[model samples]
Target: MTLCLLTITTPSAVEDVIVDWFLEQEDIGDFNSMPAFGHGSHEGKMSVAERVTGRSRKTMFQLHLSLPTVERILAKLKKDFAGTEIHYMMSPLMRAGDLTAYEA
Candidate 1:
């Protein structure tokens, strides 16, 4: 089985819900999160003029899970977040955990 590292970035307002989604998944565990900022124009409290001159601020979440689990979560996210600014990236894990054990 392939292990994947999944990273997601979305508005801070949705951080709790986004993190909760992973908590609800049986195959996923031990994730990390922190605040982040993205330089870009986006629809928000800012008007068109403000958006053009502003950068989007949001939270980023990361986790590791089996490929099948990533696929399941991504499929739903792609459909449910259509036209929204939610962005995700997945990387093939080369090695994980401590020296006690390792897997690519």
Candidate 2:
């Protein structure tokens, strides 16, 4: 199987649409999310803390999926959130699951 890892990050405002997209996928069995924040710049606009600390709140969505499923998700994200500020990546998974019963 074409096992892999996919992750996406975006501002909190887009959480609803992002979540909806994930929910719509039937092939993707499971995924996860966590609170995260990072330094970013746009339109030359920045708060004092954002300038000095260079930090902003963000939500990260992660998916463990096969190549085909990942491709479909990418197409949806590209079409649904075109021109929006978002970040994503995919990586090959060597192994996953429990230490003794690891599946590769």
Candidate 3:
């Protein structure tokens, strides 16, 4: 199985919901999330405050999983979070491991 990084961005309004959803997924071992700002004129997506600042509040979730697992999770996300301004991207992971375990 090829390892890959999956990133999902969502409106701040549904950040908790997204987190809860991820927790329910058995395929996911763990994930990381942080508050972020999305900069773009996405039309009808930005709130008044966001429009003034030219960036919308967003929450980004990232996880490392196998290629097939990532695809399956993405498909499930598409069906469950439809119309929720949820966006995602996946990138291949060349390597991931602990760097301090090596003995000189």
Q: What is the TM-score of each candidate against the true structure?
A: 0.75, 0.79, 0.90
- The top-ranked prediction according to lDDT is 3
Worst 10 residues of 2 by lDDT: 38-47
Candidate ranking (lDDT, best to worst): 3, 1, 2
**lDDT per residue (tens digit) for residues 10-41 in model 1:** 88778888778778867777889999876754
State the C-alpha lDDT per candidate.
0.79, 0.78, 0.88
Better of 2 and 3 by TM-score: 3
Candidate 3 residue runs with Cα over 4 Å from true position: 98-104
lDDT by residue for model 2 (24-70), tens: 87876667888887675751444587678777767898887888888
lDDT of 3 by residue, 1-104 (tens): 69999998898899999999999999998799999889977735677887998998889999999999999999999899878898889999976656887554
Separately for all candidates shown, the number of backbone clashes (residues 3 or more apart, or on different chains) is 0, 0, 0
Model 1: how far residue 37 lies from native, Å: 0.7
**Model 1 lDDT at residue 78:** 79
Candidate 1: deviation at residue 84, Å? 3.9
